[model samples]
Target chain A: MALTLDQRSASRRESRRPAGPRPVRGGQSPLARRQRRIFGPFLAIPLALYLVLFIGPTLYSIYAAFTNWDGINTPTWRGTDNFTALFDDPLFIESFWNTLLILVVVGIGIFVLAFSFMLLLRDMKGKGFVRGVIFLPHIVSPIVLAIFWGFLLRHDGLLNALIVKFGGEPVAWIGPDSAFLMIMIAMVWISTGFYVAILMAGVDRIPGYFYEDASLAGASAWQKLRHITLPLSWDVIGVAAVLWTISSVKVFEFIYAFGASQGQMPPAYEWNAAVFVYGVTFGGATPQYRFGYACASALVMLLLVTGMVALLRRAMRRDAVQF
Target chain B: MTRTGRLRRSISFAALGLSALLAVSACGSPSGPGDSAASGEFTYWSMWQEKEPQAQVIKAAIDSFTKDTGIKVDVQWHGREVMKKLTPSLRTKAAADLVDQSMNQLGNGLSNTGQSADLTSVYNLEVPGEGKKVSDVIPSKYVDYLKDKEGKPFMVPYEVTGEGLWFNAKQLPTEQPQTWDDLVKLLDAAKAKGVSPLALDADNTGVAKYWPLLTLIRAVGPEGMQKLASDRTGAAWDDPNVLDAVTRVEKLVKGGYFAPGYNSGQYPAQQNLWAQNKAAYILQGSWVTSETKTYAAQGFEYSSVQLPPINGGTDAVGVNFFGFGIPKTAANGEAAGKFIAYFLNKSRLEGISTKADNITPRADIPAPAALESLSKSFQEKAVYPSGAALGLKFGGWESTAFQPVAQSLVQGKTSAADFVSQVKAKSIEFWKTQG
Candidate 1:
């Protein structure tokens, strides 16, 4: 048989190719092939875990938000009633604002303080030791810290006892008027160390030569921080802000431990969204178990976190400064 | 691919398959209550912490039960956290065959939600070798408190509790205050002696409002408290009797009778203050002794009294209680029932009273001396359910409406009329959503 031009080319290409096994592009080498073999289920296991653990509960919660289920009874559909009721609820409104305040006010306080500490520690002696001490609260259980804080501020507690011993009248440091403020301050104390560590790591990655050059140029410390440090560490700050936003919304244990002496829940004035959700459900002297309503509150919190994170990403976005 | 590569891939695939199989197997079947007849073992969850005297007594009873019945029970002590865990656990296959917890441990107790077995049959069961039915031993009044909406007793009554004004025998008179005015004078006399006349668990939203609500319920009658909750018109709270109760409570708080920091003091802190005689009295439940036992001053003695009648209205008393229930999911329901019957038998309950420092629900068991003084008031002509007892309406009200307003009232941030108006408005809003 006479060979055509296409047949002649195919023969040429085939003869040029190495024999034994066919070559495949895009993750088809022997090692890649081995990886591929395990990859499906290696990926599958975690993906399945994520689906089952996180996504499944999230979806169920969303469905429950529209119903009228006490934790014990069969749920009944209540449509948007739970949402409508929540909007009208003063407690929910207070909790929402409280959450927002923690996110915005507390968030700002933490970032500024963290940045300053990071800058100070960047050039300071024995920075590692200082960091370990400051980060101690972060590593220690928040419940323990809160208990210590309470012991310090309680009526006959250490602080008040000291004041009285000094011939000063006892002050209600953790009274109703000042308790929320104390909580905010305690939160800042607890979380600032974590953020400082994150910010410091980001700042540390920048070459020390940049600061030397700035000093050579007579650029003030503030100017250097404003122009060089912040812009360079922008990505870490963005991530930190989003993390704080998410975590502050879920702030329960620290505040809840404050109420351990109070019974199932703290006073309403001290409650934030997380405590509110718990209070409406099982965390009360009498169990309300308003599961559907609590789900609605939780969904609102989820939306708040999602929205804040998205906004933070947008607001903090900048061109990557290649070092 | 190379032979080794192919072999590695096969091994990886096999490993992944094995892990997945192991994971699925690890999930296992949800554990049901054990077959007591076949395996001779059952499970129980107790709400009391093990160190508590009540837990010790129960443990002794369980030991007795095992020795007599030859059925082993596994008991888990979860304490106050039991309520948070009970509902979800009941839905699972790993549910315990029996649970010992507060009567109001679940939402309105096991009877309201039908979560536990209808223990009415347990009431008919004879206590082992005691020759008495459970009903014959436990008081009918206490049983009445345990009834569900269907008039069935879901809890086997254990500890009976009451809420009243408690005073230190060393500091204050144990005699009843003759009238509301006389009570004010007595409070003043205590103040003159450098002790605050009252202490409050005001930092607790649920507990802070108990004094005001219970007094109002008694002053206006149960019907009045019901109207305050149910009446959408908001006029129910405006009843003169309600106002009188609210005003007098306001006077007590505003009169500087309470400890200086009472409005802001946390639960059990104010209680401890009373224990140390910093305050002359505390409006507390029967468990106050156990709660403050550690804080007790040397030679400290406790006695309780009913609140004096307001405006010569009928004298009423407030009582709260705790007991135990068995979940409906229990596999060994018969064995669990027998255990409950044995636990509540008269002799066993008396031991509970003496050893646990509680008011056992069995009438045959006399109250300890600390509570004996208040027994007459508890048995008074008009029996009033404290807000705690009205679990259905009181829970949401205390959390949402009453406590916050009461906080303001005690702080002098809001007036009695404002308290009434706020409660009415909140009640209307609360009931509207409840439907």
Candidate 2:
């Protein structure tokens, strides 16, 4: 009777267990518990620290926008005057329009290339090598990257040598007419690797079984990609767009590095909003140091980015399409 | 987290916070401005930018001053971005006693902030460099930049510079251009040979890049460039001589004698044209020697000739001062004055000139062998200050306005007359606020 009871207990345990699913943690917290845990001190400290460091300074900067502090003295209130000047300042307008154009044109151009490369990433030969080369620009310091690019693109630089080899005159890569374009190309080259890697990660997350099942259903490669890859990477693409938008708006190191080194300020196209602000503040013999003006410009940019982030989040919001 | 872990993290964070706070406090600490020389400890700030050796030479000179007089100069060597930092400080009264002359900064920056000391007394006082004593050493043409509007002395002269026609002798046809026409002929030669033409950094540097214009105006005598600076609509642009000078720069660019891309830089724009040998001939300054000897990658036998007279323009180089001034509040003002006097003395000036590779502004100190030789013939033949050149004050914004308009001229989008007229109109507009 005892032996029978022991065998019965073993059989009961076996019956309770289930199969045909991926492994996961058996012990889990309830919704109420998990939500509360996130607010616990361990998480709160780090979250608060980030909020204070990045967000606090940003908020403070916004407040300072309407003030006339020369960076040395305490700030004094001045209403929308700085903003008013920024709009009328012809150079500021040119800089603003130019930067916007760059953000859109280069951002779109790079995204297409970056996404295509991401879809091509699977089973690609020498994938690590390819990724490393593409990603190097994003990893290096902007100063080093800018200096190298400047050397490559100067009139007597290596690019001219290549142009000569191709039977064309040594065109000034940083000339007034072409400076903005070369800058765009360089920026895209530097930034796309990052966007591509992110999209690739999204592509990697889409279960292979989905593609396998689609293939079994006689789906073509194009059909599989259209169905699975695009939908899966949409969120990542949105994020890349938002990031590149902000980055391209305030592009500085490149413009400064590549400004026609000797002559006229590299024809006006290179003057983005940041360059314009800098030129106004510090370009001449005695900097006007219009702190209020600069702060207002920054606030405009900050508000622009904030609005975009909110908009992007809204646009990207959809039921997480579970397969 | 365990109690131990929590304790450790807190301790570490507290330590970091304390360290950061300490760093900030330390950075904020400064000796209050009330040191009235009672302690005799003073900080001497120098706005010099050069390589390590030159800085060391300056340090040695300071040490010599300290040894000769019991006063000290705690020299803080600021680099090239001196104006960016120095200007704000001066506006706020946090400035050093002495500053150097930047390309655009002379007097306007100080006056603009309404903080310029009453320097009238300093100006009227007899300067160390004057007449035969200092004039002989410095190129006489440079004296005008140092003179105030009322012909009173303002900036104390340091290094003298002159704009000359430079060429990569190696790329040239074994002959020096004797006049402005001869140089143009060389550019024509290079274009004919299918090589790069005479390089001109016709980029954006005013007065410097427009050497032909300024020289032509100066050569045209007192009524030339100055009249243009003050006159709207370039009343003088049609002066037959002015037209010739305008045509010279345009002619060179159109002739394709310049490198593939010239007339596109900001400060010292014409420099790159000569440095790269993209243009075979560059009409630039004696400072080219400094640029060439320092950055050897610029590749060339950088040599200069007095810019040839244009049609009948003066065959002369425009020279200017890299000046120094002693602020009255100098903690060691007496010693500072002594140092300034010694620095201007031919012996000490020669010491610095040798190290700086600059032509001494004082007539007493001779230029080093190489510079002396290059400047010799021209120093004999050059014209002094042209009455027509726009008298530049610090904070002058022509640099910003003139560049685009001038570039438009180079591109043939604007006429030389328009550029000249625009300059005059802009000058008037700028002066209105300060007038």
Candidate 3:
């Protein structure tokens, strides 16, 4: 059947007589078959791993969320009880709110700082060195950064020590009201470098002539950015936003390591969704072992992230600038 | 189609199947050593790192245990996460024959799951090379405290930990306060003398609850505290005693008795301040001396005192035990029990006090000087498990509900009334999810 279709297509092509090269028979050439042979194993191995390692556990977790399992016993079905209970759970609500704040507030802080740096670095001397220096935090282990952040912000930490040395009263940098705010600021500082690199890559791809032309036309820096740089980097910005949304929900170790005291959880107020999940399950002086509840919380986070990313993509969608 | 094309297609199918098989096999649970009973050896998972002082003591005891019985033992130093890691292993044959962790951890990880073996027999087992049994060494009160809800012993205590107001003996009055008001007067005097009265790591939600819990336990009793924790409707916070306790904490907060930034900094920071003589007292576990010894003030002398009594209240002290448990599926339960008795021997257990700088269940063994006062309290006074071990059983009620409200109260962020109401609301909210 394929041979007959191929012959008919070849005869049609012969009638038109416009092609420079003939199509392969049945759309399977020797090179194509060889490529499939060589690449098929490479793709299949990771695909199998992803399905087994990621998808399998994800599906099991989703099932577990609807049950009452304490990570040791048989899970009994509880339908939507776990999900319904979550709304009334003050800890869960607070953590979810914290997660959202990190997504929106920290996200904005990171982007604003990153875009400003990207623009400034575009014309600066030793741009590479400055970029490298800014990117250093991104490459450093988050646990290490959290330790450094703690040392700088804690009540007798280096920052306060310096203030006292200079004849000033030591400020309560990590006071109850200010703890989460400091954490958000640290998140912004640690993440701005990565987004700067991404935006810079996108901005660098735009031809310099566009900016030169805009300059000739008496365009201000803001006007040039609005017309050229932003539109050109719109897709990259959308991706970065989505990345930050997902990562913000999973920001566990930094807050946990920095805020947690004596191997116990930080105060419930500082908890984001990831910390909430751990706090409810395996992460405390006395592990709660609330597997089903944690899985439900995790599922809620996943759904919220999925919806957020969908909305972000819809909002970011625009006609591509062909530049 | 050509020969190479068909050959390539076949190869691709083969590769896909091979990869799929590899993935499926990788998902299977790993098998451990065979039946320990037949081998006459037991697998023990320890809660301490091999290099830790506690582990070194336990290791020496294990070596002697093996030599005495001529029975081989396989021990793994699983560290502090042993209990958390032991949960999954309990479902499989990979589970250890013996495991050790705090009683609270055992209650949450083993007893609650019904995976802990009844340890009454172990308690009755005679200690090797010693005249007495395990129960003879450990006091009856602790043995009763270690029992499960079903009244079966599930853990054997080796080390004892008590929570109280830790202080530097050189800086603070050595005399224990007789009443809450008297303690307040003492704190005021200390403050007047230029030492901060109290140091708290409010960032640690777990430890932050110490002040309120102690006050509540003093105002009400341990049973009353348990009632407050287990109350699903949250009305227990309305108990006048709870309000009184909360008000006491508020007074301390308003009195400016806590160290500067006491409500904000991470742990050890505040505790370290207390160690450095900048603060007069820190409410902490008995381990505070060993934990802060490195940075302690140049002549710092560690000491502790139980919470001052309230009129018409029980004087039960809060105690936690570090002990050993046997899994229900353990093949070498008998041998594991023997080891427990052997380790409890006075000579062997002395290492916990002398070398590890901790208190032991055997009161006959002199406790580390810093813990001597607490050790006396543990033996002489009425004692109960801290928090009633309800923090784990009630779906993390302490961490989720009590801790945040207590933090707000102790930090002076919330009024006593507000603190009571918030705790009530949080308690109700917490129980709603437990359903």
DockQ of each: 0.32, 0.13, 0.50
For residue A239, what is the lDDT in candidate 1?
84
Error of 3 at A218 (Å): 1.1
Assess every candidate by TM-score.
0.90, 0.72, 0.90
Per-residue lDDT for B1-435 in model 3, tens only?
A: 665677889899899999997885454332221223344678899999999999999999999888888877899999988987778867644368889998778878888887777887787778887888888888998888787789988889899898988888876787888889889988988889988988888887777888888888888788788888889888778878788888888888898889998866767788888888888888888888898999898988888888786767877788899999888766677777888888988889999999999999887899998888888888888898876666645647787778778888887888888988887888887777666
Q: Provide the lowest-lDDT 10-residue window in model 2 chain B.
A: B28-37
Runs off by more than 4 Å, candidate 3: A1-44, B1-38
Candidate 2: what lDDT? 0.59
Task: Select the stronger candidate by TM-score from 1 and 2.
Answer: 1
lDDT winner between 1 and 2, please give it: 1
TM-score for candidate 3, residues paired by index: 0.90
lDDT of each candidate versus the true structure: 0.77, 0.59, 0.85
Please tell me how candidate 3 rates in CAPRI terms.
medium
Candidate 1 segments exceeding 4 Å error = A1-31, B1-41, B92-94, B107-109, B312-314, B380-382
Q: Is candidate 2 or candidate 3 better by TM-score?
A: 3
Write the residue-wise lDDT of candidate 1 on A1-323 in tens digits.
Answer: 97766567668877777766676743257788888879987998999899989999889899999998877667899999999889877788878888888888888888888887888899899999999888889998989998898888877778888998999988887777888888898899999999999988889898988989999999999999998898898898888888898899999999899864535578777889998998888776567777899999999899888988998899999999999
lDDT of 1 at B127: 82
Residue A173 of model 1 has an lDDT of: 77
User: Docking category for candidate 1?
Assistant: acceptable
State the lDDT of candidate 2 residue by residue for A1-323, as single tens digits: 44455456657766766786633332344665666666678787888898989888778778778887555456788777667656655456777777877878888888888867876777598876887788989998777777677668766667777998999876666665666787788888888898888877778888888888998999987888788887876777677778887788778877776664432244555678777666655654334555666778877876777787788788877666765
| Candidate 1 chain B, run of 10 with poorest lDDT | B28-37
* lDDT over C-alpha atoms for residue A18 of model 1: 76
**Which lDDT tens digits does candidate 1 get at residues B213-300?**
7677657666567667667667787778787888898888767777977755556678888898888888877678777888989888
True-contact fraction per candidate equals 0.40, 0.14, 0.72
